[model samples]
Target: MKRIPKSLLKKLENRKEIGTFRTLKTKTALVDFSSNDYLGLARLDAISVRAKQILTDLGHSANGSTGSRLLTGHHPLFKKVEQQIATYHEAETALVFNSGYDANIGLFSALPQRNDLVFYDAFVHASIRDGLRLSRAKSYSFRHNDFEDLARKIEKLTSASSVWVVTEAVFSMDGDSPDWKSLAAICNRFEVHLIIDEAHATGVLTQLTEIYKQTTIENHLTARVVTFGKALGCHGAAVLGNASLRDYLINFAGSFIYTTALPPAALATIAAAYEKLQDKIGLESLHQNIDIFNRSVVNLDLKQHFILSQSAVHCCIAPGNEHVKMLSMQFEKSGFDVRPILSPTVAARKERLRFCLHAFNTENEIESALKLLATLL
Candidate 1:
């Protein structure tokens, strides 16, 4: 076998020196504060039962989707689940992808032409940035969640046949959201096509309602990338838009064209998870935990150390990578699963302890975790 090149080894050495060396760890029984199962649907027995029922009903006994969707892998469940997702999200159609990364890569790389311009939020997920890099369109990023800066940048664009703007509904790391209304107004005024990644916000923001119905900007959005892996605790993603956009992606997106489809069981699980989103108890409990977390931060006077967010993800800044990693270890010792966000995942001196709250996390757990964090700080 060939050994790794010296340049790659040097990069690994740099990561170690900077305290950002990466390693995979097995899941522990520590009190959950790290996983993306925000609604706790991944462990829900009812979802498993329904998913099994779905597979049985479809007579899908296959272990894998033997080919890509364009070939033999386009299972019957795909149409059923895609329609369900479209209806739930209030879109004309939905195109399922293997994952959120696939959806972003497909949409951004295939949709935007050479004469187009894309302006994205500075802090969007790396997937979006990578997609933009593959696109023929010119792309630039504005300050994080700053619509005014976005407008200024757009105004400075000399010549572009079309304009597109991108942002996330709930930023994964910061757990904060942009001003949707303001962003919509800008897009509307400028006739800019808008794309929003709703990976973290999918089930959390609108458990009982469609996301389109919750905001006035629904009609203004050109596309919405939603993932089932986060709050839904499923294993796929979808791009929701008009029928034409879905058709275009099917015909042109390389990622979707080349990759094998998700297995029948994964699709069934995603469908079951969508149905589980209608349960008010989980949504209510998750929101309540978020509220408890906020209040505890305020009571402990730790609000200043954390980012202001209404989402299930709350980040408490701890600066240097070494410092933040140490704090995470402290939390682990206290039987919590909080993790550190290191650079260049984030900027230098902007590393943090990322706390992901979940529906199953009790008020006692919330309070205790915050108290421990406060003491450690």
Candidate 2:
């Protein structure tokens, strides 16, 4: 075997200094304040049973996508789900990808040409950064959610090249959202292509259709990317755009072309999940839970400790890596599956405990968790 290099070891050492090392774990039997299953679809027996029925009905008993989507892997479920998603989100078309990461990589690496310029929020997700890194376009970051700074940067870039403006609908860590209408207006004024990654927003927002209708600054927008892994509690993602963008991606987007299609079961699950979203009563219950969680935070006086948010995800700042980890352990001991967002994942000094709110979380559990948090902080 070839010897392991010491330089790679040094990189690991650097991560430790900043208190940002990654680890995996087994499932914990706790009241979840840290899962992305906001609507409880991931755990629903009905969804699973329906997915199985879908598979049996379609006679797609295969365990794998036999080839890339361009070849034999493009199943009928893909078309059905794509059209359903497009109609749900009120877009001209929708293209499904294997996952959120793949969708972001495919879009960023392929859409931006060498002469194009990309401007993104400084605090956008790592997947966006990775995608940008793979592109030939000149890219720069604006201050996080600072539209004025973004406008200035865009103005400068637009004079030299076509501009692509990007940001998340809701920031994953900060638990806040960019002003979509205002930002989209700015993109319109500059005649730039606007793109939003709705990975964290799709199932959480009641006004998603209104937001989508308003998110477009003009006709220049290439697309919006929405993922199911987070709020939808399923496993795949879709890029929503016009017919041309879909066709172009089919031909380009190396990540889309080079990877195997998602399993037929997964696609069926995604479809059924969307169908369930039409149940107004359930979505309302999820919103009520979010309200209850926020109220609990206020009652415990932990509001000041938390980042302001209306989404299912809430965050409480703990400052240092050691501090966040310690607090997270306390929650774990008390039977909550809260996660610690360490530095490098976020920035230094911004380490936090992230609580992912879910519809099924009882009022008692929500209050107890906040009470525990108050004691810890």
Q: Top TM-score: which candidate number?
A: 1
- List the lowest-lDDT window of 10 residues for candidate 2: 212-221
Structural similarity to truth (TM-score) of each candidate: 0.97, 0.95
Q: Write the per-residue lDDT of candidate 2 for residues 1-377, one digit (tens) a residue.
A: 98679998888888777667666798889888888888888888788888888889987657887889999899888988899999988889999998899999999988888999999999898888999999999899999999999988877655546788899888888878987777877877888887888898877775866765667653656788999998778899999999999999899998899999998888989988887776642567778888998898888788888888988889999999999999999999989999999887888888899988888888898888889989888
In candidate 1, how many Å is residue 245 off? 0.3
lDDT of 2: 0.85
Model 1, residue 96: distance off in Å is 0.4
Off by over 4 Å in 2: 1-3, 13-18, 214-220
lDDT value, residue 38 of candidate 2: 84
Number of the top-ranking candidate, with lDDT as the measure:
1
Output the lDDT of residue 124, model 1: 96
Mark the regions of model 1 whose C-alpha exceeds 4 Å error after superposition. Answer: 207-215
Clashes of each: 0, 0
RMSD of 1: 1.4
